[model samples]
Target: MTQSVLDKAFRDVVIANRILANEGVVDAYGHVSVRHPLDPTRYLLSRSRAPELVERGDVIEFDLEGKPIGGDTRPPYLERFIHGAIYEARPEVQAVVHAHAEAVLPFTVSTTPLRPVVHMASFIGARIPVWDIRDSFGDTNLLVVNMAQGRDLARGLGAERVVLMRGHGFAAAARSLPEAIRMSVYLPLNARVLTEAMRLGEVKALSRGEIEAHASMKPDDPAMWRAWEYWAVRAGCGDLLTARP
Candidate 1:
């Protein structure tokens, strides 16, 4: 890849992982993915490492089938199946993020859904249905090594950008790495806020109509993009941010 494109992808991945680590959404467990340049059937991901430690050169290219391509020297990530399953199921998604954020994991262990506790969380809406892996398939485990199980996990996401893996973390997809990062950040924040509010015992949340109204709006607002750019610069991610994707 040219320096220009490589820089953009590299920075997006690094900064995103760093921010996720800072927010306590991801530690050594989560991974992120970006669509491949030469073939949409392929994507780029890093070998297993803490989101906090993801470096620019750690990114590696792999086919959507979860096979490494090119002459890249690094080993592929163990969670590579999640990225492959997501891309296979949703062509519209350009990036994917899987993280074990604090707030989201609670819903996984119980019947509770990652409901739209707030309007801003309407991106997921009532569609944040937990995948009943046991019911879907007699087998209930879906860790990284479970490739077929990962595909079953993607089935719960539908067309939405986020899925809260029951007893697991979150798997989100977006049109770009920044958007994926934004969703990853926002989902956990929104979940935490809602969880806190509900715990207060008396809190008001948006109705389905209201949530739908907000969600129908385009997510790629210029103001938010500008905010991301500003923060990226402040975080010293500008050199990579300025590069063309």
Candidate 2:
């Protein structure tokens, strides 16, 4: 990629961090990353910093193995393996988000699965798989810090766009940064809506046909841009809207 194209990717990653923070999909704990436009073998993620405060300078390039390139000494997120392993396993994924939104936590632990109940979250499909750390590693702190744990989690994700990590958060993958951000923001909203609908009566999630239709929406669609612009302004990164990929 040219210098301009590479700068745009970093800009989008910074904006994604802030947008997810503003939208409550992520806060101080979560991280987001995008595959390098010039080299798929490398990806960009911010150094250890709160999502809301991430900036272009904080963005670091990492190999698919999750090791920071260029010998950058800044600390990295412990669970960055989540991004690397997924990118390694799924060649189609261009962006990855790992968030611990409270609304999504209940479904991670409970038998009730998180599904797409609203049109915006249709990318999640009818059901989301849950990856329990205990199932593979036997009792330990629930973090995808190593390649082994990350690969197992990726296996659980399989062909799904989203997967809940038991006792933790959910990891979302997408073909673009905007789509990944859209899924991250709407996943919790869908969960919250599903919770309320369940309290009233039997919850009717989107039918298979409905999901298939809505999931066809692409990241570059006008509607997606509208959502991204609205979120960028809300996150105080409106100026960066021009830098979109």
Best by TM-score: 2
TM-score of each: 0.86, 0.97
Clashes of 2: 0
CA deviation > 4 Å runs, candidate 1: 1-3, 71-73, 136-141, 216-220, 230-236, 243-245
Task: Compose the digit string of candidate 1's lDDT tens values, residues 1-245.
Answer: 47656556656777766766766768788988888744688887877678778788787778877877776656667778889898999988888999888778887777755677665566555567676567656664556555686687788788877877766787888877766767777788788887788788866666778777765544356644765576566655566565322
Question: Model 1: which residue pairs collide?
Answer: 108-167
**Per-residue error (Å), model 1, residue 11:** 3.1
- Please identify model 2 stretches exceeding 4 Å from their true place: 243-245
User: Each candidate: RMSD to true structure?
Assistant: 2.7, 1.1
Q: Pick the candidate with the highest lDDT.
A: 2
Give a tens-digit lDDT track for model 2, residues 145-243: 899999999999999999999999999999888889988999999999999999999988888898999877877887888888889999999998763
Output the TM-score of candidate 2: 0.97
Where does candidate 2 have its weakest 10-residue lDDT segment?
236-245
Weakest 10 consecutive residues of candidate 1 by summed lDDT: 236-245
List lDDT for all candidates, in order: 0.73, 0.91
lDDT score, candidate 2, position 205: 84
